[model samples]
Target: MAYVTPAPLTEKSTRTDALTPLGLLTVLLGAALSSIDFFIVNVALPSMGRDLRASPATLEMVVAGYAVAYAVLLVLGGRLGDTYGRGKLFRWGVAAFGLTSLACGLAPGAWWLVGARVAQGAASALMLPQVLATIHATTRGERRAKAVALYGSVSGLGVVLGQVLGGVLVAADLAGTGWRMAFLVNVPVAVAALLCAVRAVPDSRAERPRRGDIGGTLLLGAALTALLLPLSEGRATGWPLWSVLLLAAAPLFAWAFAAVERRAENTGGSPLLPPSLLREPGVRRGLVLGLPIFIGFSGWMFVSAVTLQQGLGYGALKAGLTLVPMGLAQFAASILAPGVAARFGGRAMGVAALVHASGLVILALTALWVPWSSLGPLALAPGLAVCGLGQGVELALYYRIVLAAVPAARAGAGSGLAATVQQSCLAVGVATVGSLFLALAAGPGMREAFAIVLGVQVVGLLGLAALSLRLPRRLA
Candidate 1:
């Protein structure tokens, strides 16, 4: 099979010859915030509901709105980054995110909070693609590998940290801010990142920047919004007629978007997503595997939150603390990922998947056999640790495989698409798996529902393992 090497990175019109440590950390902060915000709000939901007097459906909006907006705008964000400067866009995104977080922190009502969260998601979309794109453009060989590994590790850690930090912030209620602290916390972090980014992060853009395709962008956004909005909000909204109509229109919009993109590509215009990029075997196959992995990852967080807090009668802090072991394991695995991948090739992901599945099985059995009242965080520690480690490894390897194949010029688009798939799957996972647990819990009991969901995820993990076989044995 013939493969094309991506265009080499264009020389930065800046003083720095390479991305500095602070530069990398600043970008990683953007990546971390994007992933963290997705799960962080989960632990803060109860507190938000109580403080705002929000209905169940309104509460769901606070979460789904962000995911929907983020998924819809990500590809465009990438295009904009390629056209504009990555450093410029990233700094603006970080600043915007901080302001939005402040808005969220100060929101006096549920609807206000939802609006702020949507804006925050938009900022995230702009910021996050640049991280991967910047790394891909500026770094090479072992440095690139290490950077990507850390990126993946941070992605996993962000999810875990969200729960822990959200729990802590709400529990602390510093200055009587209560739940508002969760969003408010981002203000300082974003400030720090922005300051470092200006000095350290090199400004880089596509060698051949293309004009944005308005038709393709609109159609793509319409397609994603139609598909994701309904899935994320339908359960809460009782699957209304609008949801059905949107769902029905989703495929049409998607097909139209693809057609528009293909036309744009053939006409020498840069489509929002260049159709040719999808032709890469690595990108296509890695995306396919990523869908299920993200689904399981987000679904596990959602289910665990409900089970630990609502089902097991644990406090928010205790529930958060329970996952500490898993987070540690995830951190360790991520740190070790580059070496492991070098040794084991793509099969490392398969091994990781098996370990993840085994952990899920253990968790399910613990839920099934142990009495609900008797089950404690410690009881689930071992399984959670193993699952986290697998997740870290899987994430690191998969990211390396997918992005390693992308050309430098198209890095923004590739990274955006990857993040889009990842976030979309996360929203879907929360909706489907969470809905399943809620429905079953309404009758069969929470313990049974919990086990059943974990069992379902175990099957998905094994499927991911199978999918890993198709990835290139070694990255480029």
Candidate 2:
């Protein structure tokens, strides 16, 4: 279990090593695994429900538990990599993810599956940030730009692919594992990634590694958990006292976390998330713009799965396959993103947001007019493709601008901060937007509820459009 320590980096070294193709592939796999698992369980939920005899609430936990664990630990995971070595942390995380996936696959009951999912999420937190941090620390110029674009593509595709792959795996039911294959599939992928990472991913860490920020990390995690847990589970559990209390406690923990971060700065110690990073104009503005884009995206995915399966009576495989247009459009747009960014500069975010909003409107209209029994993949394809295109381009541009502002010396922490925003917003999207849909559907028809939720998300996208205008016109 001993890991090789990477040699110390000089302060002035602009780049550490040339990123090999194998290294890029290895890191992208880690990113894919982290993101795919988030949504993959969606299509498999019905199967899991029947197989395990789980209630509606427990099925929600199957998704929320993993997201909460992953989102909370992300900042600490990034810091650990900065202090120890990104390559070392990446290896450990991938290995742990494999083991946790096996645990999930073999789970004997609903609660055991939930526990294993939480552990899988923690492992993802350890592995994912290092992907961006490594690219930032090691690559330069066109190479860095290309790498970032590919990262965006893989990320967007991961969400789409999760749905597709989940449907395939569950339908195929390899070895008669049924829905269990959704979790089990990660085992072999993780093993291959770990081996490639050891040889290809260069070892990199912060130039001045410092002591961990235990207090700030805990406080920040507490705040996020307080906020997300209630929203994710409150409706299903009928708004219990604990859920209400947790929601009320969120703001206090957030305030305390901010204070602790400032104190660490005054004492000349490294905080898990450095406050200075947010002070940069591009970094600050980019995070704001990126937040709503991801929130709406994840929310749409969650609601779509439910609407397709429960509301419209589609099979899991059909529901998953219905997103094919979205996946294909996103893949194409992501590859074209770097060139588009080069041409449009920062205005690309505004453009992408507009495109995204337009797509959402189209989707809302489609859902409103089409009868539930009459709707099919063709009815949803146009809007899904448009949304995917905008999402792909904006995601790439946001990642480029947000991290480009950070000093390489703080790459790991900066990467963590950016990813924390991304992951946390994703969880919030499901908790708030997804929960709102579910709550409404209970009272009204599913079609009516979905249209209303899509309208709300359109407003969120409009907000993103406005925020995008404030970012710097170009990344450094």
Candidate 3:
């Protein structure tokens, strides 16, 4: 790997940036893989469950394990990339992700896949944090803004695309590979990006680097897992006594972890998460909104996939294709988001949230109105499209809103916290919303239960809408 520190792009340097496009592609492609991993597994889960004779608990573990591992390691991942060179770490993470994906695809049993997926999540954390940091370190002004917009779209779009792609891959069976095709598909794309980086991607490192906090890192990881695991796995397991005990202990562990971090900072080491970032108003508000958004979104995906396939008898490919319109709408909206934000302020977040809620409402109405056979893309198109467009616009805005309030010195900490909040919510979504859907489905058929759960999500979306009203529309 090359030791190329990021230089700001300028008129003179732009022409010399032969690797710029390649570098950007490599980064984007790597990011897309992580995004896909999150949603793509949805369609694949039932098949995996059948193949492994797994209970619902195992299926939840498969998803939660990856999310928990990824969330726990994310701050450390970003810090490691900063301490080491971005390019070197990014390349290693990408390569490891490829290996882990292969391991997941070829898994002999459910537990094995769960373990591999956790590793895959860790590799993703290492790579994803660097994607934005690299864009930030290397580009400026309009270029930076554009790159950030794309990053935002890709991040959300990944979930949508993953749903459809997983459906297709699992349904197609891809030479009897079945669910493995979903994971295996990442291999070729990763190889191509690996080649691109060899010639194009530049290296970058942290300025005013701080010592890594091993104690803080471990404590933070433990605290996050301790909180998330009980939530994600407990509902499925009927809230066993141990789950209750784990829930009780989460706060104590978190408090102890924070104290350890403060002590570490006093000793001249960088805690994986800085206490100061938490005190920043905008970043804190962003987390408040982000938590519910991700929780609702992830929970919706888990429930919908099950509803569409097992309940409605749609194939995987069909389930995946259902989200295509939303993905397209999102991509279109994200491209236009910055200009809109510039004119209207952060008001876009609230409006987008309303649009998203409307989309859910529309879909819910369609489900209620149409019989099962009549409900397809047409029924979901308008709401899903609105949701997608609004989501893309706000997601981009969230990045700016969160970071706008922080100093450059605190970028990694700020970004890491943002990611942690989002990921934690996603896990909670699976635990709460997803579990609720399944619980209800046992009494009704899948379709009705799904409708009921989505109705609740509409409430969550409206809450986001209300929160957005609190944002001062005159945004940066």
Candidate 4:
């Protein structure tokens, strides 16, 4: 027996409202905002510490809390879109994110701000996974490519732009709120996103939905908390006994979570994360490569911020300005990506990793030799700019690669899984590489520590590039 296939919906045949230019813009706006918030708050940390009288540990938590919650809930959030409606969840998340941003802005104490930040992360997790899912489901070849490129640029730009904007905002101390303005500023943007999302973003869902795997969700959340929380907080807490226990139990909990999810999937239940996604060749390669790219990326940013500010005693604005070379280089490089890929094949990414690693070595050398007071744009700018040059396209290409192997049916789950991995690696970067920088600062001190840590990042990135050379065979 043969089943009949449905007709393709052509642009001319479909309603004007479907895949309209306005719709794409709205979706793109939503994607940009989610990316921006992920890193905007970093520059605000110094002012937040003073305003809230936050301890060093709590201060770190303010950042880590958001990332951890965001990573852990993302798969579930994507699934929620599958079962309910992507449009509905996106709208709700946009609204909730606005309210939580307000809460973060208003909080009087460190703990209160931390809690609100966590809520904001949850709200973000709810909104972001739907972005690619909705776009993939709704668009076709050329349109999809353009939309994806925009998405990729926005995501990369957000991290850099966020810091620049936050630095200016914090320094400006608008209405005397100082760092609080970073959170407060999101309110208006959120409101705008909500209004546009309702009008322009169409409703979408998984064609076939199943009952959610509640057990898997619970166990996965537990495993993430067990592993991430302790690593993120342990150093500030003087490495307590319980922290070690949590670290030790992480693998066991993770295994159990994976087992539970597999069982759920086998029984016809829709697991929060489908195990089948883990088997995709391109997706798996993307995961492996994405780990080091982001780890080096996130860890370096964390260290750079502190080094520029505390180590060199520069104000937030100056530290932020120091990264202008990076941002500008990245913008230019992003536009060259397609051409580069066309000429070099997918190996453009491996070449990018090598270029970025060389830059890191130069940056590390500058910290070693250059006077803290005499540091000029020319001294290290070229290398750091090169790092940004590589980063701009390399990261997005992986996003493209991850989506390449996934089917329409698994788009939501795949996006969720990929985003979760990206988010988790960021946290791990902060814990492993970022913590190494901070620890090195305490004893070997900031200069030497910065050099050593960045050197390590250089090695990791080179290794990742080596791995990338093996990836053509892995492409779907």
| lDDT top scorer | 1
Q: Regarding lDDT, does 1 or 3 come out ahead?
A: 1
Task: Encode model 1's per-residue lDDT on 1-476: one tens digit a residue.
Answer: 11234454446643223788888989999999988887788888988999899999899899888988899999889888888878789999999999999999999899999999999999999999999888877777777778888998898899989999989988999999998999999999999999998998877788788986889889988999998999988988899999999999999999999999998889887789988999988888879989878999888988898888888888888998899999899889988888888887788889899999998998999888887779988889989998988988988876788786688788889989988988888888888888888999999899889888888998898898898787656655
Candidate 3 deviant stretches above 4 angstroms: 1-19, 52-56, 442-452
Error of 2 at 253 (Å): 1.0
Ranking by TM-score: 1, 2, 4, 3
lDDT at 22 for candidate 3?
Answer: 66
Off by over 4 Å in 4: 1-21, 473-476
Instruction: Give a tens-digit lDDT track for model 4, residues 235-278.
Output: 77888999899889888889998998888778777777778878
Clashing pairs in 3: 164-320, 167-316, 167-317, 168-317, 359-383
Q: lDDT values of the candidates?
A: 0.87, 0.85, 0.78, 0.78
Model 1 clashing residue pairs (backbone): none
Q: Where does model 1 exceed 4 Å of error?
A: 1-17
RMSD per prediction, one decimal?
1.8, 4.0, 4.1, 3.6
* Candidate with best TM-score: 1
lDDT of 4 at 318: 80
Q: Which ten residues in a row have the lowest lDDT in candidate 3?
A: 1-10
Clashes of each: 0, 0, 5, 0
